[model samples]
Target: MDFGFGPEDEELRGRARAWLTEHLAGPYADIRGLGGPGSEHEAVAPRRAWERELGRGGWIGQGWEAEGYGNRRLSLTGQVVWAEEYAALRAPARVGHIGENLLAPTLIAYGSPEQRDRFLPAIARGEELWCQGYSEPGAGSDLAGVRTAAVREPRGGAAGLLRVTGQKIWTSLAREADWCFVLARTEAGSRRHRGLSFLLVRMDQPGRVEVRPIRQMSGTSEFNEVFFDGAVAEEVVGGEGNGWTVAMGLLALERGVSTLVQQIGFAAELERVLASYAASHTAPGAEDAVLRDRLVQQWAQLRTMRWNALRTLGASPDPGAPSVAKLLWGGWHRRLGELAVAVRGAAASAGPADWAPGTPYENGLDEAQRLFLFTRADTIYGGSDEIQRNIIAERVLGLPKESR
Candidate 1:
């Protein structure tokens, strides 16, 4: 398949690059590489400000084709070009991605007209941020086993309200999110994927919703534990008791243009590691032939992953494509982290002696050290390696299901 861009795509790439360069200054200058995975705790106010900046540029929902949401409809290739440029410039990690890339598309596909009007404009304006409340303490990978319940209030003016009650673990941006898209069991005694509903709940319900940050080994709280105690959900996407379909569709959408954007970031990280290796003459194994070979292999594999992502872009639905993409990038990033620490050798273990309480992890350690510690959970967080393999085996290869 031809991976080369057309003239129009090239023009888009140039425009995107210029826009990012021109606007990523002043207050947004320091946040260029902030708010990414594990380092999400950095520059919160500025990153939120940067989201509005992106909104003003009409760069928030480039892929959405909806009319009058303040979003410019771009072709898939154009979206890819924008993403590539964004990552290339190391722009602030998007605070609106969950809404833009996931919920917006899902809304366009399955959401009600009222739902779109109510939420999409705020998302497009970067005024509202969203968190996914799908993963529970017990249903992280086995999402079908979620026990969160959303009972509809049957009395008076509260009749349309769904009282969501349960806990969601590993919810990214939970604290910053203005809303959460929750998957709950709306039917009593429902088993597995049955009786599920995709409900949107506001996060500002004072006494009903609580968000507690979960500090990781890397000393960051990007992930949070969100508790909903009779939280009210007024909107249900794709109808009630159809969350299993909507949730699965959203998961599939995860493997779209964002995969290429992620690869661009991965490539940037790899380049940084290579630069570290080149300069670390005193570090042990920096001169090792094996280490050198591994670096070369990392470059080659990253190129291969990019090709695979481009080839699969906008292709027919494949059951295993998202899983495959997840497995590839997840393992690649974890390995890159290991390589980063390995290249630094003894220096990687030593951090600042005066590390204070409540300080960001990056303050005490170098990028390599932080990268190594943070990537440890890469394969685990976004569906484990084991889960990806099972998806491929059962869905794509037609293998027998693993005995539960």
Candidate 2:
């Protein structure tokens, strides 16, 4: 299959590259590499401003087919080109991705026209940031087990506010988000995936909504615990009692151009690791044959991943494609983290000599240390290896369901 970009796509790529070069200046220059995966805690205020800048450039919601959302409708390849250029420039990690990528797509697909009008323009303008409120204390990968509940008040008829009361854990960017799309149960006696509703709730409810940062091993608190106590949810996408379908649709959209963008970032990381290995000639184990082979294998595997991603992009809806992509990159990243530390030998184990006990986590360690620590959760987040395999088995392979 020919995955190369056509003439029009090449033009799009050039335009994207030029736009990034022109805009990433003055106030946005220093923020080039800030707010990525492990470094989300860096430059919080500046990164939010950067999101607005991207919106101004019409760079946020490029894939949507709709008109007049402050976004330029682009082909899938055009979206991929923009993503590649954006990653190559090391632009500040997007604070509005959940809204632009996940929630906006979901709303376009399943939301009422009113819902889209109310939310999509703000997302496109980068005026409102969003966080996902799907995972909870007990329902990380097993999304069907979400227990958050939303109840409607009797006085306001069908348009009455749904009062949400529950907790969500591991919510990325919750601290900076202006809104959250919550998956909550609306029926009194429903279980598992039944009677669920996808609710859009505002994050600034003062006493009703609370966000507490969860400090990770990397010493950054990008993820947070969100409490919605009688929080107001005025809109439900795909109607009430149909959240499971809407949520699954949103997950399916995850395997789009974003995956290619991720591969570009991974390639850059691999280049840095290779550069480190080249400089570590005198470091112990750096000369080891096994370590050398692992580095080569990492490069080869990353290439294979890119090809696989390109080959499958825009293909028919394969139930296992998303899970397969998750498994591939998740394990590959964890191993790369291990290799990043391994190539550095003994020096990788120690923090800076002047580091004090009370210092902040970001100041205490270097990039490799942070990468190693943060990638520890790579396989666990999004979806665990076990869950991915089970999805492939049951959904794609026609295997029997696991004994529950």
Candidate 2: C-alpha lDDT: 0.89
**TM-score of the candidate numbered 1?**
0.95
Residue-level error in angstroms, candidate 2, position 284: 14
Q: Per-residue lDDT for 61-172 in model 1, tens only? A: 8877688899988887787788888888889898888999999999999998998999899998899999999999899988999999988777744456779999999999
- The collision pairs in model 1 are none
lDDT of 2 by residue, 14-130 (tens): 898999999999998998888878888889898898888888888889988688888988887777788888889988888888998899999999999999999999999889999
C-alpha lDDT of residue 397 in model 2: 98
Give Cα distance to truth, residue 13, candidate 2, Å: 2.1
How many clashes show up per model? 0, 0
Alpha-carbon RMSD, candidate 2: 1.7
Model 1 worst lDDT run, 10 consecutive residues:
152-161
What local distance difference test score does each model get? Answer: 0.89, 0.89
lDDT of 1 at 354: 83
Runs in model 2 deviating more than 4 A are 282-286
